[model samples]
Target: MIIPILYTFYLSFFDWNLIAPTKEFVGLKNYIEVFTDPVNQKVILNTLIYIIFLVILNFVIPYFISLIVKFFISKMQGTYKVLFFIPSLFSLVVGAMIFTWILNPVSGPLAYILKAIGLTMPNWSNSGILAITVICLITNWKVFGYNFILLLTGLGSIPKNIIDAARIDGIPKWRLVWNVILPMNRGIAIYVLILTIVQGLQYVFTPINVITTGGPYYGSSNVIYQTYLNAFVLYKTGTSSALAITTFLIFLILLFLEIKFVESRDKDYV
Candidate 1:
């Protein structure tokens, strides 16, 4: 892992096609190009959009659902767990293909159902927002189950005595969850949150590659997709390396802020 990263950083300063015999020294030009290009900028924006949507689907929604299952639902809890987790067992490529067929605007089962109900299926591939949403959905379908189970475990691990005490004290359920359970589960929450942001990007790559290929004028492309395009398809090795390095730096910064945020929250709880 470290070797590839170190090599990528070294390669970022040299101009080379993937097949080139020798790389030409380019200094910082590749990095400058990655930052200055309009397409790359749009890809960055798309990446941020992906993260926001992914966090909502893979983190926020699962967090709430886990709470509901852990505290509210009494019947069929095991059944619900199995149902929620079934999707996680599918590979991303298979999941992407499955959704592609299910969501095909023309002849997909969804389109047929919508048409039977006197509605037309919107061609999601035609719109940037929809395209990104479709990709996120594929990723979410595969990721949400695992996240839900993890959060459920975290919630379940909260000491029953504390919960019983809260109830005996006539504390509202919401207050108990907000003021006590959430803080107590911070470590698990932090891990899940970080995993969502990082793995979300990686997970979407398959769907984007299989379905959209960053279509609608590269509207659905992300940092990882752009790097793959540059290195493999476009054969701009240096630019791809530079983009990878810059993306690593961006993620490093985000991770740092995340830790600081988690630490601050911990201090507040103390």
Candidate 2:
């Protein structure tokens, strides 16, 4: 990892196509191009959108569902967990192909069901927002189970004595969860948040590649997809390296902010 990262950084300062015999040092040129390129701006925007969708669908929804299963439906929790986790066991390529067929506007069961209800399905593969939405939903569906399992473990780790004390103190169930459980699960919550942010683009990559290939336009493209296009498709190694470095820096900053924020909040809670 260190070697490749150093190599990529070294490449970012040069003009080198994959076929070139020798690299030409073009210091800052690749970085400048990456910043000035309009397509890169679109890629960044799409990545941000992907992160937002991932937080909502993958993190928030699954966390709440896990809480419900842990507390409200304890008797069937094991069964529900197994069912939810089944999707995550499928390989990403297989999952993407499965969803592609399921959401096919022509012959997919989803389209057929909608048509039976006198409604039309949108062009999920060709349209911009729709394409991104479909990919995000598939990603969420595949990963939600894993996240739920993590959160369930977090919830389980809380001491039953504390919960009993809260109950004896006449705290409502929701209040106990909000006031005691959530704060106690801060470590796992932060872990999940970081995972979502760092792997957000990667989670959707396979689906986008299989289902849209960055789409009717560049609608579904994220920074990772753009990097792949630059290095492999276009053979622009320097630009791809620059893009990768830029993305890494962005995530580094985000990770720093998240850690600082969570630490401060944890201190306050203490």
Per-residue CA lDDT of candidate 1, range 1-270, in tens? 999999999999999997979999999999999879999889989999999999999999999998888887846777878999999999999998899899998999999999999999999998999999999999999999899888888888889999999999999999998999998898779878988998899889999999899988999999999999999999999999999999899779868867787767767767
**Over 4 Å off, model 1:** 254-270
Best by TM-score: 1
Displacement of the residue 11 alpha carbon in candidate 1, Å: 1.0
What TM-score does each of the candidates earn?
0.92, 0.91
Alpha carbon lDDT at 269, candidate 2: 65
Candidate 2 per-residue C-alpha lDDT over 1-270 given as tens digits, one digit per residue, 9 for 90 to 100: 899999999999988889979999999999998878888888888888898988998899989988888877877778888999999888888888888888888899999999999999887777878888888888887888888889999899889999999999999999998999998888778878778777767878888888788876798999898898899988999999999999889888878877786777667768
Candidates in order have lDDT scores of: 0.91, 0.87
**Residue 230 accuracy (lDDT) in model 1:** 92
**Candidate 1: lDDT of 46?**
95
